[model samples]
Target: MATTSTQRFGIFAALALVMAATRVHLSLFHHDIWDASWGVFFLAGFWLRGTGRWAFPLLMAEAVLVDYVVITRMGISFWDHYCVSAGYWFLVAAYGALWIGGSWLAKHQRGIKLSTLGMAVAALLVSENACYVISNGSFYWLSAHVPAPKSFAAWFENLGDWYLPFLETTAVYVGLGGVLHVLAVQLARLSQHSGQTQH
Candidate 1:
């Protein structure tokens, strides 16, 4: 059997694609608090590491395509309902921040230790908070949805409602990704050991 680079990254790539698709579906149909796209973005950088430069942009492009399809084909009316304006473009920065945080954390990758888990959680929180601020702040300020008088207090209040859900969702998904990565590595090691014994 032969393995190309894509094949080598097959598991992570498949996971990323599934997560991305789920995100799109959730956005269009569910619109729930448990969004997975942000976590998947972070996982992409964590898993891809050196490949993140290209991977992050590719994922962002996927997001944009999904949003377009949702609004145009699915009759979601995201543009009409949500105040995107130029602020929507800020998602590039918001999501990029997540990618950078994940890439940085990957440099310190370790087993499922308390220290590693804490570090990952800390990084995730920072990235998630930054993403929320950028995304929410942009929408509040630039979205035509907001009336003439933009109330900073009102935005903060809305943020308070959303912030916890954002953190919880990201934490849950990232934790799951970590568990999956660890299990996959252990399974691969066990398989290799069995092959050695067979010979």
Candidate 2:
């Protein structure tokens, strides 16, 4: 149990680092890397499932801090930024959707199997879509950036425009995370087996 706790802490730290590193500059490796905030939240839920009471809020704070720094560095007031608005608060719910999806996947996972992979994919899709709806819908309907007299047709079209890019970017990170998770599990099993043999 101690080992599991340590491992979970390690994963949480790594995800937090990834989020800060990718988000702080808003561009990484000279614009080659997209933000990993979405992926980090999902992976956090999976790896740090039981720690959400503190872990989730900590990550959320880190996200806000990173944004504050990035926006300020650009000579823009954080509150005056185009993305900052009443709608912005809805991100809590948007990200919560991702965290819940990941937790659900962790609960349902029955080992590193085909079914597990399917579950992960399903969870990602459902969570990402829900997140998109909440975040995007809130922005479109509640933010001052969007002109008044909004229509469902325009909003739906807007959703279609950006949905794929967000999904694809998040998929890239989560897919990589999935591979690393499988490798870590396999390595742990091998180490355990080796220990048993020595005993």
Candidate 3:
């Protein structure tokens, strides 16, 4: 759909604000829709499209700042609580994969086709699985909290246990987003046709 510069910026800004709120919720509540963190990334990428290049960094910084405040004010060690380390930086790559997948989808497809929808779902699965492996693998290998010497199968099993929640969250957000996008397009078309009839 064609959009004005102001419209594009406003949409992106709104997404950023919502994501910021979601981060705050996750930080304070510490549960109940933590998957919004993951959902927002792909949503931002899908909606922001070209602007996603910048939105991702901003959203990531927001997440990091929220974590910093939570750790500092709440009097908890992030490393101890989350088992983070230098490996935590791997999150960049993980999230980048998600962003890339969504951006690719945006560029390749305009209206949703079944084939494109399948591709989008596949992309999310691939990106989420990659994120799980990179983020969790790093934690398993590089974090001080993981007892020395872990088995691959054990790690694989652990990865499986957590995978469904992440997948479900991403699917829900993306699926809802797709539906909204379709509705918006249909409305725009209807409005445009009405304007043409008035002439």
Please give the TM-score that candidate 2 achieves against the real structure: 0.95
Model 1 — which ten-residue stretch has the worst lDDT? Answer: 1-10
Q: What lDDT does the true structure give each of the candidates?
A: 0.77, 0.88, 0.74
Model 1 misplacement above 4 A: 1-4, 7-12, 75-83, 196-199
Alpha-carbon RMSD, each predicted model: 3.1, 1.8, 2.1
Worst 10 residues of 2 by lDDT: 24-33
Name the candidate that leads on lDDT: 2
lDDT measured at residue 35 in model 1 versus the true structure, 0 to 100: 62
- Which residue window of length 10 is worst by lDDT in model 3? 31-40
lDDT of 1 by residue, 1-199 (tens): 0124774368456756776677667766776445678888788777777776666777788888777776677665657646457799999988887887788788885756789878888888888889989988988888887787878898998899888888788888888988887887789889999999999
Q: How much is 66 displaced in model 2, in angstroms?
A: 0.5
> After superposition, which runs of candidate 3 have C-alpha atoms over 4 Å from their true positions?
1-3, 77-80
Per-residue error (Å), model 1, residue 57: 1.0
Question: After TM-score superposition, what is the CA distance of residue 76 in candidate 2 from its true location, in Å?
Answer: 1.1
Ranking by TM-score: 2, 3, 1
Better of 1 and 2 by lDDT: 2
